[model samples]
Target chain A: MKLGPSRFLGRRRPREYAGGGRKAAVQLYHVSKSYTAGHYALRDVSLEFGRGEFVFLTGPSGAGKTSLLKLIFAAERPSEGQIVVLGRNAPRLGPAATPPLRRRIGVVFQDFKLLPRRTVEENVALALEVVGAPRRDNRAKVFAILKQLGLQHRRFHHPLSLSGGEQQRVAIARALVNEPEILLADEPTGNLDPELTVEIMDLIAQTSTRGTTVIVATHDYGIVNRYAKRCVRLEGGRVVEDAPAHGATP
Target chain B: MSRAAAQLASFLRAALRGITASPLTSGIAIATIGVTLVLLGAFALLVANMERMLDDVGDALHVTAFLEEGLAPEAQRELASKAATVEGVASVRIVSKDEALARFRGGVGRGAALLEGLSENPLPASLEIGLADGYRSASGLARVSGSLDGLPGISDLTSGQDWVEGYLRAIALVRGIGWGLAVILALATLLIVANTIRLAVLSRRDELEILALVGASRAYVGTPFLLEGLIQGAAGGVLALLLLYAVFRLVLPGFEFGLELVLGGVAPRFFTASEAALLLAAGSGLGLFGAAAALASESRP
Candidate 1:
């Protein structure tokens, strides 16, 4: 399948590279993962995501979309392949190297996984606290991001008290608080209503404009179709189609 | 605040938050630790004072010569007078059976009532002799005992030197047992705290994974639990010290006169500054150790 830039829909076009020149933000070569004998979750899958690109990974249940994203996030090691994330060799990075690498990357899971006992702002500020950022700086960044997400009023509320959509936004806010170079979101809108879905997707799509590489794994075709970005469809542990943005010349 | 100071404050806050979050579990853990520390403190106090008592008894060497039952009063007096002139003997006095019985009743204290039912005094009259200063050394004492052996009309001799040696042996045995008990209790503390921390870790497993995902270091993820354990242990130590002080200053004093009748009234001493500090330090150190053990065994994805 041909892959190229798509229409920006009146937004600033996120820069796209013509071919491999600068190192990819994420690259997987011949990657494979297995839980037991003869049941591979991923197999010989090779893909590259450039900096400042927004891509969608689409598949039905058991289609390896989550596995592929997890591999890139360094949450799981490949059985027999080389995976490089933002320049460091993933498998060789060891335990000591994961935190720094993970700091440069942000990941959002479907469950939100917000600390229930922490307040909304405290939950978001956790991203800054771990890095030993100054309290004033952490507070400023947390509040600014919360305000941008329309969550300033709920900053002091506990996560459990927030609705599903609000919690997801807080999760996203936490992911983007540090201005990470890469963001991996898995089914971020799976539990949201239609209107909230669009709001969350738009919020996520807006991050690409600021030079953050975003990869969203989802089964929602309508959402994917509307956004009209590069889409990689996975089936049975392999990439079946790599389609570029709609209305772009191949 | 400085960066390190800020981090410590954050860690402490997290620990306090955790403690307050599950008061039941934390309370149970803290109570278990406090009781353990009190037991350790009480044992230490007992052993320290017992050793002091042994030292005092060791320094005052004396010999007792028992006469056969129903010995003539003149013969007892003659024997005591002769013993007083023996070389290395400082002084000698004869004690009647009545005096012996009175001393026995006094030593037994509350148990003195048991003797009231006795048909007659079973005690034997004897000569109580003190050793001169030169004969108080171990060798000198042994030599005096040898001289006293097989004296005329003397049935059996009890030497303060022998009792002192026996007391030392008993003290050593007791200390060995105390150390063993301390070791066992320490191991129990570690296991209990480790299990408690492990449960705490499990309850917050999602948060820990999130922290790890957000680029928090293992040390960062584990520090708060370490602090939790340290606080629990140190708090338990403080509680134990309070318990010990209450026992020493309030409870044990009421029994002082009775105890003096038997063990000579050497009151149990409270732990010194260094000893109390050690307990606190040990409590915190064990807390850290327990958390470390739990972290080591944690199964990370």
Candidate 2:
């Protein structure tokens, strides 16, 4: 792996950290999660995502792709094994510490998970709002991001009024609005057409270019092939393939 | 901003926005709280007024001691003096047998004819003994009566101790019943608030989950609902206060008139400021606690 300049910069210089880096953005060793006794959602898995690297987590439904994303966000704790993001050791992070870690990561769900009652702008602003960005700055920032996403025209419209692709774009805008260190997307283009999928991937790639460590979990082979990033494929709660985007064979 | 402050601000903003988003539901919740508070307030006022009336009646009561007919005026005067010295006795007055007969005759002028042909007045002379307020208990009066029985020239002695004792017991019983009812009603109020908040939480479960996922602490998620509960409780308290005031305004005049006709005096029907404040605090506390209980129960992992 070739170390990129983007890897060494502090989190403040988000744009300077763009491109492949040697340092791991996230590292998990033998991580396993079970909701109930003897029912494992994820088996022993070890993986590392480098800074500013764009990667695809490909797996079938119930293959623990969502669970993996959740673990990164500290939404679910591992029953066994070490999971670390940034510098914090997860599982060891108490309930009180989880929020600060979560603040460092931005997540986009497959459902676009936008609050239907809230406007497009509000949905994007929600990320900043939760972190207590000043009201005046939040409004300006929200508008700037909405305009960047070409959602300025529908900024005031409720999410339900938007098309599937548009809603997904809003979700991306929300995930990126905070300029977090790591971006985790679960099936970001799951319901979109191929063209919209490409557009979303381009936006995600652009986000990585801005120095966010982007990890997208999806079943879309076209997205993985077109993007030509690192790919980590999962099967039956275990990693089946981990390779560079072009050279990967499953 | 400091982290906790920042988190609190975020929670407040989100909660305010959420409540504003569903104005109709919030309105209903506030109204429910108000109505319940009003019911409680009205009940409290009724209890307060009943207690006041009992106090007034109790204050006027005195024990009457009838003497044997053979006791002379000197003996009656001595008895009065001795009665006044008893531990519970506030004051004592001697009533001669002739005066007693005259009073009886005056009470039944036409009926006095039914007692014609009586050779001598058969009525006993009496001493009226007023008891001190603190020592007006049945047991205390019984002690006085027992000591009076040992006095010389007191062939037969009678006091209104039995009736006074029964009245005291009745008052205590009524007060116990009133308090029991109040407690039951308060619990019911708490249940109502808890159930309402639980529904509110359920309706916004997705929002709460998202907030939680995004690093909103349990307190942040719970505070808005707690505030909602406080709002509901305060509104209810105000409503109850208003309802009580309205009832007192509308019904008190008629009640006072009836009481005046029966007891020959006017009585007031209003709670003191302290009493109202206490009631309001109680209603609000119940609301806040109920909501807190519901939130705590739901938020537990």
Write one digit per residue (lDDT tens) for candidate 1, span A109-153. Answer: 889989988899999999999999999999999999999999999
Which candidate number would show the highest lDDT if scored against the true structure? 1
Residue-level lDDT of model 1, residues B1-301, one tens digit each, is 8999999999999998878877777776777678877877777777788877755665677888898888899989888888887888898989899999999999999999999899989999998888887776555667777888888878998886665666667667877877787788888888888888888999988888899879998788888998998898898888888988988888887887865853565655678899999888877787788878877887544
Candidate 2 lands at a TM-score of 0.82
CAPRI grade, predicted model 2: acceptable
Q: How would you encode candidate 2's per-residue C-alpha lDDT over B46-119 as one tens digit per residue?
A: 55655565467557656678877687788889888887887778888887888888999899989989778899
lDDT of 2 by residue, A115-226 (tens): 8888998888877766667767888998898889899899999999999989998988888887888999999888888899888889888988887999999888877887
How well does candidate 2 reproduce the true complex, by DockQ? 0.35
